[model samples]
Target: MNDFKSLKPISVYSTKQAVDDGYLIQVDQKISQEAGIRYPVYLTRAVWDKYVEVPEGMEGHQDQSGRLWDVLFMFAFFGRKETSSHLLFKLRVHLPNTDNWEHNEKVAERSNRLLREVTLKALVTAQDFDDPSPAIFIMKPFED
Candidate 1:
């Protein structure tokens, strides 16, 4: 085998750096704990803005905390069925119907809000390659 130890990485991005740079938002400890997650959990910023952030004009109907809770709870619920470090789960959420379906009568019949299913990927791993502390990261299906 090639000498892997001789190779040096040109750049490195740790989980802590991602959190500090706002690329990853840490889920509240209390919420994760209540959701039966014993490890620290984080949601990629893209995931947060897309699903967890309540859209404009939806202030009273939904809040960030509740949205986040749904995500964590659903992950926990599905995670219990598997023992893998990586998990793929689907969460059903209500979001403003911004799709243009005027041509499709079937879709147009839906109300202003639509219940949508979104796929999220969760990885349970160490805080960093060198750190053994367990942690979790939830992100969109394609995100790293």
Candidate 2:
């Protein structure tokens, strides 16, 4: 008979483990590319869930790419847990590596409408997995 007391418990997740699991690699790569950075390069997600203070109405919607995450976009949020609710979308874009705020701002204006009030920032750091094996981080919306 299957005994509930003998059932194996599931393990929890850690950030560093996530780093090894290739969690945001695809999103990082694409974002880096759009931001004009090279791929396979390692950096950390800035204003991340662990660090950034999500506004009262904002939340994070992580992308779950499974084995095909390369085509997904990492979107952010700032609000309640309803599909139709009005909130905010967060997208942190990296500015040119060099000090070029003017061009960066201009780019934002042309590319993303969310840049107006949704809030945005550009920073360095998205940890690239050192391991060669491709892994995945199960992503989902940050629900309260």
Candidate 3:
């Protein structure tokens, strides 16, 4: 049996293990390239900053081979209302090749940026809000 109140669970997350989720590559079409130098598709990105705080030691990172792209932080924000929910997410960035690395930083930056950006949907007006919408919100307060 489980407790109804006064219950909490442990949580752990890391940008270094991001590849394990497989969403990074699967979600972004721009990264669907075999050759690192090639990205036939265009990348997307968030229009504005989206995050509360990046925590203390959970910002950007660099790997042994120097291939890095920190999580920045994932934000679930709404463009229509305070209680809206969806795939819309934001992430900050700092790729090792962001400007003058072995790889084309533009490409890396573009693809990484794309992963945070959605497929680009039409915005909803205040009038378009559906009350009784249950007031949606997002926070990855759980683990797989």
Candidate 4:
């Protein structure tokens, strides 16, 4: 058998460090609890900037809390159907015209906004290398 115990990591990145470094944004515990998520939840900076944060022109149309709720709610709904450590779920977001055309072009003519469906990945794992408490980390599908 391989001697795994002899191997040593070059460096370690903890969840708490990630949050402090701005790489991970911790979701409000209360909001997550309201969505039926029992554990702590976090979002990658990319996910936060793209999906959760409302664009400058979309101030009246959407808010951060509502967008965050949509993400958590959808995850909770899909999470109940599967028994896996990782989950890929869909989120429909109303995006403002910010010159990012990679998303769906389906639009609501009245508002001139594009409704795009994005897939995000959620990972359930220990809070840190030494901490076994469960936590959920949300990020773009391609993110590590």
Clash count list over all predictions: 0, 12, 1, 0
* Candidate ordering by TM-score (highest first): 4, 1, 2, 3
**Once all C-alphas are superposed, what RMSD does model 4 give against the true structure?**
2.6
Clashing pairs in 4: none
lDDT of 4: 0.87
lDDT, candidates in the order shown: 0.83, 0.33, 0.26, 0.87
lDDT string for model 1 (56-110, tens) is 7788999988989999999999999989999998877666678732211123224
- TM-score of each model, in listed order: 0.85, 0.22, 0.19, 0.88
Q: Per-residue alpha-carbon lDDT of model 4 for 16-129, expressed as tens digits?
A: 899999999999899999999999999999989988999788899889999999999999999989799999988788886667855423344545457777788999999889
Weakest ten-residue segment in model 2 by summed lDDT: 64-73
The digit string of per-residue lDDT tens for model 2 on 1-144 reads 879988765965544665677443234566535534343333224323222323333344333222122212232222223243223234343322334233113344656533322232322223323444332222222321
Q: Candidate 3 residues 1-144, lDDT tens each?
A: 877666654653432233355322212323222223121211111211211223234355423111111221122122324343343433333422222222111232454632222222221222112333222122222211
Better-scoring candidate (TM-score), 1 or 2:
1
TM-score of candidate 4 versus the correct structure, residues matched by position: 0.88
- Better model by lDDT, 1 or 3? 1
Residue runs of model 4 more than 4 Å from their true location after superposition: 1-3, 103-113
In candidate 1, the residue pairs with backbone N, CA or C atoms under 3 Å apart (3 or more residues apart, or in different chains) clash, namely none
